[model samples]
Target: MIEVYTDGAANGDPGPSGAGIFIKKGKNNYHYAYPLGILSNHEAEFFAVIQALELCRKEFPEEILSFRSDSKLVVDVIEKGFTKNQKFLPLLQKIQEEAAHFSFFFIKWIPEKQNFHADKLSKKAIHLNKS
Candidate 1:
Protein backbone atom coordinates (compact mmCIF):
# COMPACT_ATOMS: atom_id res chain seq x y z
CA MET A 1 0.00 0.00 0.00
CA ILE A 2 1.10 3.56 -0.65
CA GLU A 3 0.35 6.47 1.69
CA VAL A 4 0.08 10.04 0.53
CA TYR A 5 -0.15 13.20 2.63
CA THR A 6 -1.06 16.42 0.89
CA ASP A 7 -1.70 20.01 1.87
CA GLY A 8 -2.30 23.40 0.27
CA ALA A 9 -1.99 26.99 1.39
CA ALA A 10 -2.54 30.50 0.06
CA ASN A 11 -1.26 33.78 1.38
CA GLY A 12 -4.69 35.32 0.95
CA ASP A 13 -8.18 34.04 0.17
CA PRO A 14 -7.39 34.28 -3.53
CA GLY A 15 -3.68 34.84 -3.55
CA PRO A 16 -0.45 33.04 -4.32
CA SER A 17 -0.82 29.40 -3.40
CA GLY A 18 1.04 26.14 -3.29
CA ALA A 19 0.50 22.41 -3.07
CA GLY A 20 2.61 19.98 -1.05
CA ILE A 21 2.69 16.23 -1.47
CA PHE A 22 4.48 13.56 0.53
CA ILE A 23 4.39 9.97 -0.62
CA LYS A 24 5.54 6.90 1.22
CA LYS A 25 5.79 3.28 0.18
CA GLY A 26 7.39 0.87 2.61
CA LYS A 27 10.75 2.42 3.39
CA ASN A 28 10.84 4.78 0.43
CA ASN A 29 9.48 8.30 0.38
CA TYR A 30 9.01 11.25 -1.98
CA HIS A 31 8.27 14.92 -1.46
CA TYR A 32 7.04 17.64 -3.75
CA ALA A 33 6.37 21.36 -3.24
CA TYR A 34 4.66 23.05 -6.12
CA PRO A 35 3.70 26.68 -6.55
CA LEU A 36 0.19 27.32 -7.84
CA GLY A 37 0.08 30.90 -9.15
CA ILE A 38 -2.98 32.50 -7.54
CA LEU A 39 -5.96 30.57 -6.23
CA SER A 40 -8.38 30.35 -3.36
CA ASN A 41 -7.35 28.20 -0.39
CA HIS A 42 -10.01 25.61 -1.17
CA GLU A 43 -8.93 25.51 -4.79
CA ALA A 44 -5.36 24.97 -3.74
CA GLU A 45 -6.46 22.12 -1.47
CA PHE A 46 -8.28 20.41 -4.31
CA PHE A 47 -5.31 20.94 -6.56
CA ALA A 48 -3.03 19.34 -4.00
CA VAL A 49 -5.13 16.17 -4.03
CA ILE A 50 -5.21 16.15 -7.82
CA GLN A 51 -1.45 16.61 -8.01
CA ALA A 52 -0.85 13.76 -5.58
CA LEU A 53 -3.19 11.48 -7.48
CA GLU A 54 -1.34 12.20 -10.71
CA LEU A 55 1.97 11.48 -9.06
CA CYS A 56 0.73 8.15 -7.77
CA ARG A 57 -0.65 7.23 -11.18
CA LYS A 58 2.72 7.92 -12.75
CA GLU A 59 4.86 6.21 -10.11
CA PHE A 60 2.70 3.55 -8.51
CA PRO A 61 -0.33 2.94 -10.66
CA GLU A 62 -1.14 -0.53 -9.40
CA GLU A 63 -0.83 0.10 -5.72
CA ILE A 64 -3.66 0.73 -3.31
CA LEU A 65 -3.58 4.34 -2.16
CA SER A 66 -4.44 5.94 1.18
CA PHE A 67 -4.62 9.70 1.03
CA ARG A 68 -4.57 12.08 3.99
CA SER A 69 -5.29 15.77 3.93
CA ASP A 70 -5.68 18.61 6.41
CA SER A 71 -8.60 20.09 4.55
CA LYS A 72 -11.88 18.76 5.95
CA LEU A 73 -13.84 20.08 3.00
CA VAL A 74 -11.69 18.31 0.50
CA VAL A 75 -11.70 15.06 2.44
CA ASP A 76 -15.42 15.12 3.06
CA VAL A 77 -16.26 15.92 -0.53
CA ILE A 78 -14.03 13.15 -1.81
CA GLU A 79 -15.31 10.63 0.71
CA LYS A 80 -18.91 11.49 -0.08
CA GLY A 81 -18.17 11.40 -3.80
CA PHE A 82 -20.05 14.61 -4.40
CA THR A 83 -19.83 18.35 -4.14
CA LYS A 84 -22.48 21.06 -4.38
CA ASN A 85 -20.14 23.88 -5.36
CA GLN A 86 -20.02 24.25 -9.13
CA LYS A 87 -16.57 25.75 -9.05
CA PHE A 88 -15.22 22.52 -7.54
CA LEU A 89 -16.77 20.19 -10.07
CA PRO A 90 -13.76 20.21 -12.36
CA LEU A 91 -11.32 19.65 -9.54
CA LEU A 92 -13.41 16.86 -8.08
CA GLN A 93 -13.77 15.25 -11.47
CA LYS A 94 -10.03 15.35 -12.07
CA ILE A 95 -9.35 13.79 -8.67
CA GLN A 96 -11.84 11.00 -9.32
CA GLU A 97 -10.35 10.36 -12.74
CA GLU A 98 -6.86 10.02 -11.35
CA ALA A 99 -8.02 7.90 -8.44
CA ALA A 100 -9.70 5.48 -10.82
CA HIS A 101 -6.25 4.45 -12.01
CA PHE A 102 -5.36 2.96 -8.67
CA SER A 103 -6.39 -0.50 -7.55
CA PHE A 104 -7.97 1.03 -4.45
CA PHE A 105 -8.20 4.57 -3.16
CA PHE A 106 -9.15 6.05 0.21
CA ILE A 107 -9.05 9.61 1.51
CA LYS A 108 -9.33 10.83 5.09
CA TRP A 109 -8.93 14.03 7.05
CA ILE A 110 -6.14 14.62 9.56
CA PRO A 111 -5.46 17.38 11.99
CA GLU A 112 -3.08 20.11 10.92
CA LYS A 113 -0.67 19.06 13.65
CA GLN A 114 -0.51 15.55 12.30
CA ASN A 115 0.04 16.92 8.79
CA PHE A 116 2.82 19.32 9.70
CA HIS A 117 5.33 18.08 7.17
CA ALA A 118 3.11 18.62 4.16
CA ASP A 119 1.83 21.88 5.62
CA LYS A 120 5.38 23.15 6.03
CA LEU A 121 6.23 22.17 2.51
CA SER A 122 3.20 24.02 1.21
CA LYS A 123 4.20 27.13 3.13
CA LYS A 124 7.69 26.84 1.69
CA ALA A 125 6.24 26.71 -1.80
CA ILE A 126 4.18 29.78 -1.01
CA HIS A 127 7.34 31.60 0.01
CA LEU A 128 9.05 30.55 -3.19
CA ASN A 129 6.14 31.89 -5.19
CA LYS A 130 6.75 35.29 -3.66
CA SER A 131 10.15 35.51 -5.32
Candidate 2:
Protein backbone atom coordinates (compact mmCIF):
# COMPACT_ATOMS: atom_id res chain seq x y z
CA MET A 1 0.00 0.00 0.00
CA ILE A 2 1.15 3.52 -0.76
CA GLU A 3 0.52 6.06 1.98
CA VAL A 4 0.36 9.74 1.15
CA TYR A 5 0.21 12.70 3.47
CA THR A 6 -0.70 16.10 2.05
CA ASP A 7 -1.24 19.64 3.25
CA GLY A 8 -1.59 23.20 1.93
CA ALA A 9 -1.15 26.67 3.32
CA ALA A 10 -1.66 30.27 2.26
CA ASN A 11 -0.50 33.59 3.62
CA GLY A 12 -4.08 34.82 3.51
CA ASP A 13 -7.49 33.44 2.72
CA PRO A 14 -6.69 34.02 -0.95
CA GLY A 15 -2.99 34.65 -1.04
CA PRO A 16 0.28 33.00 -1.92
CA SER A 17 -0.10 29.28 -1.39
CA GLY A 18 1.79 26.01 -1.50
CA ALA A 19 1.17 22.27 -1.56
CA GLY A 20 3.12 19.67 0.38
CA ILE A 21 3.10 15.94 -0.29
CA PHE A 22 4.79 13.07 1.52
CA ILE A 23 4.63 9.60 0.08
CA LYS A 24 5.62 6.34 1.72
CA LYS A 25 5.73 2.96 0.06
CA GLY A 26 7.29 0.09 1.90
CA LYS A 27 10.77 1.30 2.88
CA ASN A 28 10.78 4.20 0.41
CA ASN A 29 9.65 7.74 1.12
CA TYR A 30 9.32 10.90 -0.94
CA HIS A 31 8.62 14.52 -0.13
CA TYR A 32 7.48 17.34 -2.40
CA ALA A 33 6.71 20.96 -1.67
CA TYR A 34 5.33 23.06 -4.46
CA PRO A 35 4.60 26.77 -4.52
CA LEU A 36 1.22 27.44 -6.10
CA GLY A 37 1.63 31.15 -6.68
CA ILE A 38 -1.66 32.73 -5.52
CA LEU A 39 -4.88 30.95 -4.58
CA SER A 40 -7.37 30.47 -1.78
CA ASN A 41 -6.58 28.05 1.05
CA HIS A 42 -9.26 25.65 -0.12
CA GLU A 43 -7.89 25.75 -3.65
CA ALA A 44 -4.45 25.04 -2.35
CA GLU A 45 -5.75 22.07 -0.41
CA PHE A 46 -7.40 20.64 -3.50
CA PHE A 47 -4.27 21.25 -5.55
CA ALA A 48 -2.18 19.40 -3.02
CA VAL A 49 -4.30 16.31 -3.47
CA ILE A 50 -4.24 16.75 -7.23
CA GLN A 51 -0.47 17.06 -7.28
CA ALA A 52 -0.07 14.05 -5.02
CA LEU A 53 -2.38 11.96 -7.18
CA GLU A 54 -0.42 12.92 -10.26
CA LEU A 55 2.77 11.80 -8.61
CA CYS A 56 1.22 8.53 -7.54
CA ARG A 57 0.01 7.90 -11.06
CA LYS A 58 3.49 8.45 -12.45
CA GLU A 59 5.42 6.53 -9.81
CA PHE A 60 2.98 3.94 -8.49
CA PRO A 61 0.30 3.35 -11.05
CA GLU A 62 -2.40 0.77 -10.22
CA GLU A 63 -1.20 0.61 -6.63
CA ILE A 64 -3.50 0.93 -3.65
CA LEU A 65 -3.27 4.51 -2.38
CA SER A 66 -4.26 5.89 0.99
CA PHE A 67 -4.32 9.67 1.23
CA ARG A 68 -4.23 11.57 4.48
CA SER A 69 -4.96 15.26 4.81
CA ASP A 70 -5.50 17.82 7.51
CA SER A 71 -8.28 19.50 5.57
CA LYS A 72 -11.65 18.02 6.49
CA LEU A 73 -13.32 19.97 3.73
CA VAL A 74 -11.19 18.34 1.07
CA VAL A 75 -11.67 14.86 2.53
CA ASP A 76 -15.41 15.31 2.89
CA VAL A 77 -15.86 16.71 -0.58
CA ILE A 78 -13.97 13.82 -2.14
CA GLU A 79 -15.76 11.21 -0.06
CA LYS A 80 -19.16 12.60 -0.94
CA GLY A 81 -18.20 12.79 -4.62
CA PHE A 82 -19.66 16.27 -4.75
CA THR A 83 -19.50 19.75 -3.34
CA LYS A 84 -21.98 22.60 -3.19
CA ASN A 85 -19.27 25.22 -3.73
CA GLN A 86 -19.17 25.87 -7.44
CA LYS A 87 -15.67 27.26 -7.22
CA PHE A 88 -14.41 23.78 -6.33
CA LEU A 89 -16.30 21.88 -9.00
CA PRO A 90 -13.40 21.79 -11.40
CA LEU A 91 -11.01 20.68 -8.70
CA LEU A 92 -13.39 17.96 -7.60
CA GLN A 93 -13.64 16.76 -11.14
CA LYS A 94 -9.89 16.65 -11.47
CA ILE A 95 -9.59 14.68 -8.25
CA GLN A 96 -12.14 12.17 -9.42
CA GLU A 97 -10.32 11.72 -12.68
CA GLU A 98 -6.98 11.21 -10.98
CA ALA A 99 -8.45 8.78 -8.50
CA ALA A 100 -9.82 6.63 -11.27
CA HIS A 101 -6.30 5.73 -12.34
CA PHE A 102 -5.56 3.80 -9.18
CA SER A 103 -6.84 0.30 -8.54
CA PHE A 104 -7.80 1.47 -5.07
CA PHE A 105 -7.88 4.95 -3.53
CA PHE A 106 -8.86 6.14 -0.08
CA ILE A 107 -8.79 9.50 1.63
CA LYS A 108 -8.92 10.19 5.36
CA TRP A 109 -8.97 13.34 7.45
CA ILE A 110 -6.31 13.52 10.12
CA PRO A 111 -5.78 16.02 12.88
CA GLU A 112 -3.38 18.87 12.20
CA LYS A 113 -1.02 17.47 14.82
CA GLN A 114 -0.79 14.17 12.98
CA ASN A 115 -0.10 16.01 9.75
CA PHE A 116 2.88 18.05 10.97
CA HIS A 117 5.30 16.83 8.34
CA ALA A 118 3.20 17.94 5.41
CA ASP A 119 2.15 21.08 7.23
CA LYS A 120 5.77 22.04 7.83
CA LEU A 121 6.65 21.35 4.24
CA SER A 122 3.79 23.54 3.07
CA LYS A 123 4.91 26.40 5.29
CA LYS A 124 8.45 26.03 4.03
CA ALA A 125 7.20 26.24 0.48
CA ILE A 126 5.35 29.41 1.33
CA HIS A 127 8.57 30.93 2.67
CA LEU A 128 10.49 29.76 -0.37
CA ASN A 129 7.88 31.30 -2.64
CA LYS A 130 8.28 34.63 -0.84
CA SER A 131 11.95 34.72 -1.65
Candidate 3:
Protein backbone atom coordinates (compact mmCIF):
# COMPACT_ATOMS: atom_id res chain seq x y z
CA MET A 1 0.00 0.00 0.00
CA ILE A 2 1.08 3.54 -0.71
CA GLU A 3 0.68 6.19 1.97
CA VAL A 4 -0.14 9.74 0.93
CA TYR A 5 -0.40 12.82 3.12
CA THR A 6 -2.03 15.90 1.65
CA ASP A 7 -2.76 19.45 2.81
CA GLY A 8 -3.95 22.81 1.49
CA ALA A 9 -3.30 26.35 2.63
CA ALA A 10 -4.58 29.80 1.68
CA ASN A 11 -3.38 33.27 2.53
CA GLY A 12 -6.95 34.18 3.46
CA ASP A 13 -10.36 32.52 3.53
CA PRO A 14 -10.76 33.05 -0.20
CA GLY A 15 -7.31 33.91 -1.33
CA PRO A 16 -4.36 32.47 -3.15
CA SER A 17 -4.04 28.82 -2.18
CA GLY A 18 -1.92 25.75 -2.76
CA ALA A 19 -2.01 22.01 -2.42
CA GLY A 20 0.70 19.87 -0.83
CA ILE A 21 1.20 16.17 -1.10
CA PHE A 22 3.65 13.73 0.44
CA ILE A 23 3.75 10.18 -0.81
CA LYS A 24 5.54 7.23 0.75
CA LYS A 25 6.07 4.00 -1.08
CA GLY A 26 8.29 1.56 0.79
CA LYS A 27 11.45 3.50 1.65
CA ASN A 28 11.02 6.12 -1.03
CA ASN A 29 9.26 9.42 -0.49
CA TYR A 30 7.83 11.97 -2.91
CA HIS A 31 6.70 15.54 -2.39
CA TYR A 32 4.62 17.92 -4.45
CA ALA A 33 3.25 21.44 -4.20
CA TYR A 34 0.77 23.09 -6.54
CA PRO A 35 -0.34 26.69 -6.55
CA LEU A 36 -4.01 27.30 -7.07
CA GLY A 37 -4.86 30.87 -8.05
CA ILE A 38 -7.74 31.82 -5.75
CA LEU A 39 -9.97 29.55 -3.77
CA SER A 40 -11.38 29.04 -0.32
CA ASN A 41 -9.36 27.02 2.18
CA HIS A 42 -11.87 24.19 1.98
CA GLU A 43 -11.62 24.19 -1.77
CA ALA A 44 -7.87 24.05 -1.57
CA GLU A 45 -8.09 21.09 0.80
CA PHE A 46 -10.33 19.25 -1.63
CA PHE A 47 -7.98 20.08 -4.47
CA ALA A 48 -5.03 18.70 -2.53
CA VAL A 49 -6.67 15.32 -2.37
CA ILE A 50 -7.57 15.51 -6.01
CA GLN A 51 -4.01 16.33 -6.93
CA ALA A 52 -2.70 13.43 -4.91
CA LEU A 53 -5.16 11.06 -6.50
CA GLU A 54 -4.13 12.20 -9.94
CA LEU A 55 -0.50 11.66 -9.13
CA CYS A 56 -1.16 8.20 -7.82
CA ARG A 57 -3.13 7.36 -10.90
CA LYS A 58 -0.09 8.05 -13.02
CA GLU A 59 2.59 6.70 -10.69
CA PHE A 60 0.89 3.92 -8.76
CA PRO A 61 -2.01 2.70 -10.77
CA GLU A 62 -3.99 -0.28 -9.42
CA GLU A 63 -2.26 0.11 -6.09
CA ILE A 64 -3.95 0.42 -2.73
CA LEU A 65 -3.96 4.02 -1.58
CA SER A 66 -4.13 5.22 2.01
CA PHE A 67 -4.69 8.95 2.11
CA ARG A 68 -4.26 11.18 5.12
CA SER A 69 -5.44 14.73 5.54
CA ASP A 70 -5.75 17.20 8.37
CA SER A 71 -9.08 18.51 7.17
CA LYS A 72 -12.02 16.67 8.69
CA LEU A 73 -14.43 18.20 6.23
CA VAL A 74 -12.52 16.81 3.27
CA VAL A 75 -12.15 13.41 4.88
CA ASP A 76 -15.80 13.16 5.90
CA VAL A 77 -17.02 14.31 2.54
CA ILE A 78 -14.89 11.77 0.70
CA GLU A 79 -15.58 8.93 3.10
CA LYS A 80 -19.33 9.40 3.00
CA GLY A 81 -19.32 9.89 -0.78
CA PHE A 82 -21.71 12.80 -0.45
CA THR A 83 -21.78 16.52 0.22
CA LYS A 84 -24.65 19.00 0.32
CA ASN A 85 -22.59 22.14 0.03
CA GLN A 86 -22.87 23.48 -3.49
CA LYS A 87 -19.25 24.56 -3.56
CA PHE A 88 -18.03 21.11 -2.60
CA LEU A 89 -20.40 19.04 -4.70
CA PRO A 90 -18.33 19.30 -7.83
CA LEU A 91 -15.11 18.70 -5.95
CA LEU A 92 -16.62 15.64 -4.31
CA GLN A 93 -17.69 14.32 -7.66
CA LYS A 94 -14.19 14.76 -9.01
CA ILE A 95 -12.77 12.90 -6.04
CA GLN A 96 -15.13 9.96 -6.50
CA GLU A 97 -14.27 9.81 -10.15
CA GLU A 98 -10.55 9.82 -9.50
CA ALA A 99 -10.79 7.32 -6.68
CA ALA A 100 -12.59 4.83 -8.86
CA HIS A 101 -9.43 4.30 -10.86
CA PHE A 102 -7.71 2.71 -7.90
CA SER A 103 -8.56 -0.78 -6.74
CA PHE A 104 -8.59 0.35 -3.12
CA PHE A 105 -8.70 3.91 -1.91
CA PHE A 106 -8.94 4.80 1.77
CA ILE A 107 -8.90 8.18 3.42
CA LYS A 108 -8.32 9.03 7.07
CA TRP A 109 -8.44 12.18 9.17
CA ILE A 110 -5.32 13.00 11.14
CA PRO A 111 -4.45 15.74 13.61
CA GLU A 112 -2.78 18.83 12.20
CA LYS A 113 0.31 18.08 14.24
CA GLN A 114 0.65 14.74 12.50
CA ASN A 115 0.46 16.42 9.14
CA PHE A 116 3.43 18.74 9.56
CA HIS A 117 5.28 17.88 6.36
CA ALA A 118 2.32 18.47 4.12
CA ASP A 119 1.46 21.61 6.09
CA LYS A 120 4.90 23.06 5.46
CA LEU A 121 4.76 22.15 1.80
CA SER A 122 1.35 23.81 1.49
CA LYS A 123 2.64 27.00 3.06
CA LYS A 124 5.57 26.92 0.67
CA ALA A 125 3.18 26.53 -2.22
CA ILE A 126 1.18 29.53 -0.99
CA HIS A 127 4.32 31.62 -1.30
CA LEU A 128 4.85 30.27 -4.79
CA ASN A 129 1.56 31.77 -5.92
CA LYS A 130 2.44 34.88 -7.97
CA SER A 131 -0.96 36.45 -7.56
Q: Best candidate, lDDT-wise?
A: 3
2 or 3, greater by lDDT:
3
- Steric overlap count per candidate: 0, 0, 0
CA RMSD per model (angstroms):
1.0, 1.0, 1.0
Q: Model 3 lDDT vs. the true structure?
A: 0.94
Better of 1 and 3 by TM-score: 3
What are the TM-scores, per candidate, against the unseen true structure? 0.95, 0.96, 0.97
**Model 1 lDDT per residue over 49-112, tens place:** 9988888888888899999999999998998889989999889999999888877999999999
lDDT of 3 by residue, 91-112 (tens): 9999999999988999999999
Give the poorly placed runs of model 1, Cα more than 4 Å off. none
User: What is the full ranking by lDDT, best candidate first?
Assistant: 3, 2, 1
lDDT of 3 at 49: 97
Off by over 4 Å in 3: none
Local lDDT at 73 for model 2: 97
